[model samples]
Target chain A: MSLELIKDILLATVPLLVIFPSLFAFTTWMERKALARIQNRIGPNKIGIPCTRIGLFGLGQPAADGIKMIFKEDIVPRGADKLFHLLAPILALIPAMLILCFLPLEFPWGKFMSGQVQAFLLDSAVIFFFAISGLATLAIFMAGWASRNKYSLLGGMRAVAQMVSYEIPLVLSAVVVVMMAGSLNAKEIADVQTGFNWFVLTPWGLAAFIVFFVAALAETNRSPFDLPEAESEIIAGYFTEYSGFKFALFFLGEYIAMFAISGLAVTLFLGAGDGPFLAVAPWLSVVWFIAKIFGLIAVMIWLRGTLPRLRVDQLMAFAWKFLLPLSIFNILLAGMSHHVTVAYPGTTAQVVTWTVSLVGMYVMAKGLDKISRSTAKPREYLYAE
Target chain B: MSILGGGIFKGMAVTLRNFVGSYFSKERFITTNEYSWRPESELPQSIGDYPKEEGEQLSDTTTVNHYSRNFPMLLHDTGEPMDTIRCVACQICERECPPQCIYIEKSTEKKENADGKPQFYPAKFDIDVSVCMSCQICVEVCPFDAIVMNSQFELSTPDRFGGLLVRRDDLLKSNDYYHKIHPQEAATRDERMAADKAAKEAKKKAAAEKAKAAAEAKAAAAEAANESKEDTE
Candidate 1:
């Protein structure tokens, strides 16, 4: 049992430690590059190989940045809570790794490698992923509280408010997938999404995907939803007092969390590791999974580069007044379809139900928008004579 | 504006357009130029490529002519064996400088210049660019037309305090440099100087002629007075 535990830990940690850091390094570079392109600027291209003189189009940037971060002076505030201040980043980072244990790196169609490809295939992995992710909220709050700074405290408060508010909708959308699959197992969820139709193609699943994605943005503190650490407003939020490796840790945690959440989104909606010829080459599933995650990340970067941040009130309203009600409706719609699809799997009843819910969603959204529009921020305009 | 998710889709479309257009389109050329790094030999090569011929302005974007304020400089003769500074140690500029950044010391041991006159060259000249307001007041007050503001403002240095204190050698630029930067001004100054020299020469010639004619009249009057004395005897 001890040997088994050791083996499991090694399998889990190898990816988490090795793949994630490299992935994070490159993802950061990608985000910077993509954002630069959107804004019409060169991102990073100076650090060239010494002898060969080939810069490789700024591939050395991440390595240079990593080294610079490592060499930077570590600063801890004089009045900080020494324990939690030190512990916060660690707490924040561990959840992403913990999540990697349940997350399937490879989901071979009808070909099992005794579940060795995945670190763990727990039945309750979906709920567990959500639960583990919740720890990050505490970590952020701790970082803020420990710093004894007003900005940090406010950032912590925002983190708590934003995370708790959006988490409800996030889970509700996840529950839609759960109800449809009739199983809490992640593998089962992904399996159900196979064949010609991915869940995102379905009407109800489309609504749920939108909700899930927006909520995921909030959950992971991606921009447009990144109110907790809004640099202009809160001065780097909870990590204001952190420096050097500690700050780097926070950054790493953020990127890894993005990966973890996007992975889950893929599994639930995009059909994880399910692609053409997956029945023949099961390993190709990993490639499909990675490709989907990267696609989602690219979208995230695009949104960040394009959209302005939401006002605090607007952000709260978006989570509570907008996303919450929409997701609740989505859950009901998903449950009804799940019931129909179970009795008569692949029947027109499912299609009818999907169509009904979609129409209902549209009408309800329009009604809610009408009400909100009346009460929302007024748009004053000038009259031209 | 109040439509359901329409604004977001529009914004996304704009971003997508920028992403694609930045690469392939001339109209949407990325304003970002990676200009930080270059080989040491690149500057002269670039300068060579630029049209240095008269009457044609440079069309290069990298050309540094956007409101380039040449720093105040002292014009100097390049090949002369003697100390060649146009400034005659005049203190008008020293007293008139608003910021009082310019410092000058007249040479106690004056040197004989080309005109065989005792010339008071500045023994030491320095300008604390840190304190300088760059108002061109010193340039205005210079009686000898010695000081001129150069069209080069790239005077940034690593040292925050003392390094910006420009020395005598650093402040000196060739008259050619001044002409290059201010062609019109230099031409006008040259014309005025030439006219003044011509005026002085004409005055000298007139005075010499007048002296010669007066001497001839005096000799004739003395000759007449002597002849009249002889007749009386």
Candidate 2:
């Protein structure tokens, strides 16, 4: 039992040490370089050791930045709540890191290794992922209330509001995926998505996916939905009081959150790590898994590079009006499909489910548009009474 | 258009074009953002390939026009090992300068020119670029065409007194470097100088010819007087 516990600990620890730093660094480099390219500028091309031309085109930059952050002075405010201000960064960082524990990095190995590769397995990992990610909002709140700055406090409030607003749609969309698979196990969901038969290949799954992706963007505090940490408006948001290693911790948390969220998205919609001929090679699935994660991350960066932040009122409107309703309807469609597939069985069942769900979703979307349009137009006032 | 997230898709397409357009056809980004710290030698002269297509070779600094005048530099003749600071310590630029950023100390030891008149050059020339507004007043006020502004703009430095102070040696640029940056202006200046030189030479030649004619006319008149006297006797 002790040996088993040690082996399990090693499984989690090995990926944590090797993968997290390299992953975070790569994401940082990729985001900057891609953002630069999108905006038509060269970003971070010069940071490296003194002599060589082998700078890897700003790959060394994150390391340079990380080192710089470590050496920076850690300052604490005089009027700050000493305990929580000290704990804020730790609170913010731990949840993002812990989310990685449930994310399955599945690879196929026939006889030599375990068939299903995961750091740890839980039957209710989908529930665990949503539950754990929801806690990151608390961390943001903790940082804000503790910092003693009004801006930091406001940022903490925004984080709470946005997270609460988006979490409904986020969880609702994932519930649809969970309903489709009929199991909460991450690996089992991936197994169903084998051979290009991903849930996203269907209309209902596609809508859920779009909703989930947008909510995930909001949840992770990415741009267009990045009001919680909008640097221009909020002056570093909850992290305003943080500096040096404390600031670096917040950054680390964000990067890890991005990885975890995108990793979960890959598993849920794009067939976890399932690709064609992945069964034959087995170990090749992990490569496919990583590629999908990076691909999703690239999309996130593209969105960040492209879109401007929404107004606070506009942001709230989008969550309540569009995402909330759409996700609920998606749950309805997913449940119906599951019911029909079990009751009737075979291709006719699939065809019936497809037609009903697609048509139902289309009708609901039109109804939503009309409702929004009507509500958007306010009556004019004749007098300034 | 009422399309779902229409603005987002449109903005995304625009960025996608910029991202992809940067690779295939770079003529779109006409003016690259010139970072102050990036070395002039390391700047991208033309839009480089997107990182995926080709390995981004560090590009040359952009070809700036004659008017992009960031800072002023002294033009030096390449013939005599960078001989002559074009500024003669006239101080016309010094007085006319709005910022009064230029400092000129006249050389006490003056050397006589071909005309046997003493010519003065600056002993110590400095332009506090930190203070200079880059208005090109010094270039305008220079009488000898010595302070023509050159387009080497990157003047960012760490030190205030040491780094921001433009020295005489660092300020002097070769005539070729000036022409490369400001070809039309350099050419026009050279033509004007050549025309002035030609007119001066023409005036000198005419004076010399008139002097010879006067001396010959005096000799002829003297001979006539002698002949007439002899005939009368």
Candidate 3:
């Protein structure tokens, strides 16, 4: 890479680093506000200047929270392994930040010239992004083990188990997209999704997209799957020993993962950088991209508010028994379809087979729903006066 | 099945609708009790000022001027009239009251009144109504059942000190009022009283039989002693 290429990388990477932190902060506010409404209570409404008599929307709450978190005495447990304890949060945060560097914000920087050399840099670039994000599990495990708390240890163990289990499905889902676009690179994948027919329109693409989205939710340690925090039991999980800005880093890491995953979802499943047609501005694609990602983030928040965390056993079972098999099946089917299409060229049998398989999948799913309903025991209630 | 996308489409559609709906209005999306929207007329009397039109409507039901009688006046439920509560000046309720809200003064009358007996009536019975927690412990432990919680929860006051303090007559309500406030509890208590009455009658009958047997045995012993004395003579 030339100096101009390096400068372009910096330009892209630095702005993201700055942009993502603020995005994390705003997402946190959205989650809190949404949760408050769900649980039928006011949340964080006491902060900010009163509009003479009323606080008026509590606009300054996030600022107040940030200040409070900063001032909190940074606590380090006496029994904790001091080096790993200090290292855990940073470990957890870095890979999440690294993910931002690889996320295909746009196709790429077009062209760069350094001194005597001239070259075309990818409007879309490298395939290493997914592999780097996979390393976030190590940080999580390190945080869990280093804390010297049993809850932390259990949480760490669950984190490893969940990440490792779901990672297969997560990767397999990505494989469908990779196979379709014939590129390991995210930007290339986004490039394949331009104009009218985004890759998400394809059968394999749709299946992979849903699987990837669900896997991302689990990957981020978000609610409905946030057994790691298990407030009722674990008391804030792996970050139990962390406080102040160090704690904020873990907080930042979670939100950034949320942003990165949603960005990935939009790119893969939805039209990556496409917006509604308008003659006025082509740049609205960026706005559309941001909106779609934010929309995904809001659903995560909604899930957090509405659903209880799945039991550890239930989560593991779902991953291994259901997601793993389906993901494998999806991968094999996508690979076979691609291979046959290449070999036969114009055979109509491939489309017929695909259609039949889809029909079979729908029937099986409906049957399962029926079985689930029939087997579900009515909730017993005590009507004591 | 292909059209439905294996139920995944259905699932996605539900969540997509939910996602879109969450943005527009959370209240519309949310299914929850609307306690705040309940009309004031339907609402139970609150801690603050009772809504005026409802209060006036309530006031029209009964005309009780016992408040102006000065010596601890209590309102009847109907508000049409005031009935003097038959308090025998037993300060047991006052002493047992947890909040120390209830107060009583008792002085014996030298002259016997209409009941042909002289005891004492509460000269000044006062209960600081605002301080009462409405726990009804005073009502529960009262041997006389003289004090009771009323359905008239509209005990709002402008002044915390003077206006809120309910005097003896103010706190007092009729027996019928207690029956209205806690009908089921009163009915249960009455059932228990009848049972107790039946148990007492059976116990009395058994006692009388035992006494008669003991008397006959004693008489036989006396006759035997007299016979022995006559034989010795």
Candidate 4:
């Protein structure tokens, strides 16, 4: 019985560990190539198949980078807290990897199991995912404080502030889904939206999804919201003192967190593995889940390439004044929409609810934008003509 | 007044267009493809085969246009570079160069140039291209029409100190080569040099004729005076 329990646990957790890190490697390559194309430059086309001149469109670049990162000298500052500095990357990575199991991705191997096998099948799995992912902020702060560098400290503080500020909208937006599904269980939430009824299809769901995505971007420290590790401002933020494999760990942690958050986004709104051919071939759901995650990741990469980083003030204002109020209003709208759907269950009722919710969300968003906008006064030049 | 965050979508659309357009339109996007590596056959052997058109996209290291000027090269008329070298070793370019990258050692004995005029050749002419700013200052200061900018920019070498110091022989490119690289500029330069040469020859010829006429008149006057003296005696 004990051995079987261990086996089931391994079966549930092993694939995630094997798959996501490898996906992180591929994502780095894809991001470089995509960003290069966007800027009209060829990126990493030279390095390819080893021991030969034949370039395989630079696919082997990630492996080469990994080797380089491993072989690099690990540097530590004299005044640094050596133990915490060493522990920080590991700490940052743990929460990110821990949250991956809660994504509600059902594999074909689950059928062979004697009992239902999941990494952590909790009643409040979504809340647990949020609670664990929030620990990544502590890791950032630890890295910053341990480094004994002012820039690193500032980066740590900014990350703490940004992640904390954005977490409100991030959780609140997911709350709409949780409320709709009538459970905080990720699997149940996903199961409720089984057939073309993705939460994002509805008006409030769309608003909630938008808010969630924007806040997710902040949560992952992805650009426009990537002010924490802002290279120009903070010199790589908390990991400024880290070098070699430690630095690589931080990078891996960050990308893995991206995958984790994107996966959650898919689970919450994109109908988690629910696709057209699910009835014909049940196992294709895994592919559908991963594809949806990749879709979100692709959009994230596209946004990173498209948008510039927001200023400190703008980032705070965006999260607090804009996303905070908007998400709260969306929750109320979602509640009203839910009651309306229950009271009048017909096509005409559905149409009316959709229109009213859409219009209401739009008006609220416009009002929030107007309120949050800071009026800039024209500059008066005294010396210059 | 405007829709909120509409600018982000518009910007995303522009990037999307660029990302997709790069694959189809090689000329409009991904221009580095034109000048990167290519097969040996397409690569230029001499300056004649080099691309001279204003915006002609080629697939070789020699993918340079007419207006793209780099470091200075000495222009020779024809035949061997040393035999027909245009530089008189005047050191004008060497003295006038902003960075003083040019180093010239004047020959002890004079050698006849392409025009059959005796001129001091540069025995040891070297230009440290590493120090050259590519400002075309040496070309501007050169009165002999010897120095002109070469369009070849792929000057990377393993031997930093020795390889970058371009010797006199390496610097000497044929006039035909210059004409191939920069047709319009070379044409105008050649025209001006020809006109100057012609004007000098014309001035010399007129001076000789006037001197001969004056000598003849002086001889006549002297002869007339001698005959009159004989008659008086």
Candidate 5:
């Protein structure tokens, strides 16, 4: 029984450990190349296949970077809390790696197991995912406090504030999906979003998805919401004191978190693994699922290249004033639409709900924008004219 | 009415156009290619296979436009660069140089210029390129129309102090090279110089004719006076 348990554990974890990190490496290269292209410059076209004249468009760059990062000198400040400082990157990396298992990605290899197996199949998987992911904030705070640097501490503080503020809307927006799906199980959530019944197609679903995506961007410390590690304001935020492999760990953790969040977004909406030709080929579902995640990642990259980082005030205002209330309103709309659909169960109900929610969300969004704008007073300097 | 998040979408569209157009329209999107390597032509496939010789690398890589200017070089008309050199060791350019990078030592003896005028030449001309600001003041203040900006910018070398101080022999470049590098500016300068020379020659010829006419009239008057004296006698 213990052997079987060990076998099950290996089956569940080994693939995730192998797949996601490699994906992280590839994503780094892709982000660099894509950003370079957007800026009208060629990036990293020097390093190619080793010991050969043929250039594979600098594909070997990430490997070279990894090797360099590994061999770099690891420095620890004399005044730093050596234990916590060392513990911080591992802490940051754990939750991100841990959360990847919660994604309902079924593999063809699962057939070899005696029964279907997942890493952690809790009844409240979505809640568990959120609960674990929140630990990343503690890691950030620990890293900041342990670093003994003002900028690192400030970054940690900013990260905590931003992540805490944005988490509300992120969870609230996912609530729309949980409400509609009638289950907290990630597998069930994904299963419910089959065929053309994607939650994003509905009005409340669309509103919640937008809110959720924006909140996710903030949660991941992505640009336009990247105040925690604002290079101009704070030197690399919580990881200011980190170097070498520890720094690489933090970097890996951040990108993996991005993947995990984007994965969650795909499962929540976009009909996870629901694409054409699934009947003839069952394995295509995995491809569809990963493809959807990539689609969201591509959008994130595009947005990162397009938008500038928001100021602290602007970031706070956006989360509290705009996304929070909008998501709350969406929950109400979603509940109403759900009941109406159940009672009538026809084209009429869907049509009415779609129109009312669309118009209602638009008006609410505009009203929120006006209210926020009206209330914002110009900064009053104490000493300056 | 203006849409709320429309600005973001517009910005995204602009970036998307740039990202896509970079692959198709090299001239319009990819501006750095002109400064860097070209994949199709002389660029080696691998970094390890890059040209080893400095001259080969520079010749293969550096392609500055005609308008691009660097440090000043002395222009000579033809034949030996030192013999036909236009610089007369004039201190005007040296004085006018903002950074005082140009150093000139006038030759004790004089040489005949292209115009057959005895003029002092720069015996030990040197320019510290490291100190040069490339302000073109030296080119502007050169009364002989000798110093003009060179387009060769790949001047990096390991021997710092000695390498950067360009000597007279290295500074002297033929007028044909000047024309090749900057055809328009050289042509315009040549035309202006030619016009000035023609005007000077014309003025000189006119003065000679006037002097001859004065001398002939004086002789005629003398003869006439002599004849009158003889008639009186």
Candidate 6:
């Protein structure tokens, strides 16, 4: 690429770098508040209230927590491999930050120019987004391996296993979208999705959306699938040896990952940055995009609150046994359907694709319902012996 | 394929329903003043309430709003007022208390009972209510059933120690008071007591029969020895 292109790329990155972190922080607050509601408990309602009420139900809880984390004592384990310990959090954080570089916040600012590309959007973004997001697993594995704790090692191993297992389904799910959209660029995907024909309404798009959503949850290491940081089992997993601002970096990375995944979901399924009367008021799409993201985050919080976590084996089985095959099938079907649709416009092949997808979805859903029913055991009350 | 999207929509529809349902299910929503409004007497005693009773139902109405009210409400079981708890100066509660809030002084009563035996009563039974975890361990382990968890959980105080320190007079309750809070369990325990008494009576009858048999055998042996001696003479 020319120097001007390089300059354009750099300029484009600055806004995303700033905006992405802020989005992560926003999600952190939203997750807490939403989960609190789901769990039937009041979240932080204390800190920023007018007067310093002793137990004024801390409204500024997140702010207080953030402040506390900032001033927390940074601890480096005496026995840990010092270099790895130092590198782990940075490794964990960098990839999450970098993934935002390709995430399309909106369609190219106003009619994509030839040389000087806009700041907020990307031209060929989808491939770039997936590739970078896929790299987060590397950062996670490094953090886990570097920690030098047995728990950290196990967590790292699980992180790697989980990431690797889910990555297939995650990518395959996206591949279906790519097949239909016929481009690796996210902006084009978004552009197509604008108006009533949102991808979530399409056959491959719906499947891709579902798989992608589940995969996003797995990738972010959020609840139910958070075997890595399972407080009960591994005790904060990869970050067990980390503390203070270093730990904060890992913390921020997680939230940013959530933000990125939410954004990606918006782009792929919900019609990224597309709003009512977007032809008239294009800026309204940003609100729609954020709303979609927040909605996903709310679901994440709901899952966290309502569901008990999955076992490591259960999580792996979910990825490999269920998600992987389905995603692969979805990808194959999408490609075939797309090819056939292109070869013969309005043919029986398209109808076949539609019918097969419907039947397949019904079967999968029924199977899941059965699995869930059989697997779910009621919690027994313990009368103290 | 449209039907496939139907499943996704169905899922979203359920989520939407949940989103609406959540608004109605504000019962789970956490509030700072969740339990503040309910009176101490109204507050439901959980498992670990000091001075335990069987089958106590703690009220949900006693949110934090009731807790913030600036008054000490005397705890009651139903309508009858229970100003004190049945904690004997046994110090068992004090020693076994996890938080070490209870303090007791065992003293012998100089005044004799109808049997002319000294009565044991606690001179000072003080529970530093501020320190009490309300874990109810004292109620669980109390041998005499002297101490039980009370339903009065509202113990918020401005002075951590002053008003919160429950004196012996503050914690005492009658057996009738316990029964009122948990009548069914009390009745069941009463049934157990009757069964135990009946069992003791049956054991006594069996023991008497064995004693009489042993006495008759001894007498027969003595008679035989006497008769043999007479024949020898």
Name the best candidate (by DockQ).
5
TM-score of 3: 0.60
Give the true-contact fraction for every prediction, in order.
Answer: 0.68, 0.65, 0.00, 0.62, 0.73, 0.19
Error of 1 at A176 (Å): 0.6
- Can you write out model 1's per-residue Cα lDDT over A1-385, one digit (the tens) per residue? 6886676556555765787789888998888888877876666766667567687768788888888889999888889999999999999999977786666676342135234667667899898999999999999999999999999999999999999999999999988788777788887788887774588887888899999999999999889989889998989999999988899999999999999999999998899888899778768888898899999999999999999998888888888888888888878777777777778877587778878888988877777677776789765667312
lDDT of 5 by residue, A1-385 (tens): 6998787778888988998899888888888888888888777777788888666877888899999999999999899999999999999999999999998887767645645545778789999999999999999999999999999999999999999999999999999999999999998998898887888888898989999999999999998798989997897888899899999999999999999999899889888778899889877888998888888989989998899989899999999999999999999988998898899999998899889999999999999999998999988997445
Model 6 misplaced stretches (Cα beyond 4 Å): A1-10, A49-61, A107-127, A339-344, A347-352, A364-385, B1-233
**Cα RMSD, each candidate:** 16.2, 15.6, 13.1, 12.7, 11.7, 9.9
> What CAPRI grade goes to candidate 3?
incorrect
State the lDDT of candidate 3 residue by residue for A239-295, as single tens digits: 777789888878888888788778878877777767667246655666677888998
For residues A132-185, write the lDDT of model 4, one tens digit per residue. 999999999999999999999999999999999999999999999999989999
Chain B TM-scores of the candidates: 0.65, 0.67, 0.52, 0.74, 0.76, 0.52
Better of 3 and 5 by TM-score: 5
Report the Cα lDDT for candidate 1. 0.80
Model 5 is docked with a DockQ of: 0.41
Model 3 lDDT tens row, B1-233: 24423444455455556555555665543333233334658764664545345333123222222111111223223232222344566777777666777777885663233334554667787777667666666666665445545544345655579767766545555545545545775567657756876898899999999999999989999999999999999
How much does candidate 6 score in TM-score?
0.65
Q: Which parts of model 2 have CA positions greater than 4 angstroms off? A: A107-116, A341-349, A377-385, B26-233
Quality of candidate 1's docking, in CAPRI categories?
acceptable
Candidate lDDT scores, in order, read 0.80, 0.79, 0.66, 0.88, 0.87, 0.68
Candidate 6 residue A59 Cα shift, in angstroms, is: 6.5
True contacts kept of 2: 0.65
| Residue pair clashes in candidate 5 | none
- Across the candidates, what are chain A's individual TM-scores? 0.92, 0.92, 0.84, 0.96, 0.96, 0.85
Tell me the tens digit of each residue's lDDT in model 4 across B75-111.
8998888888999999988888878898999999999
Model 4: per-residue Cα lDDT at residue B146 = 94
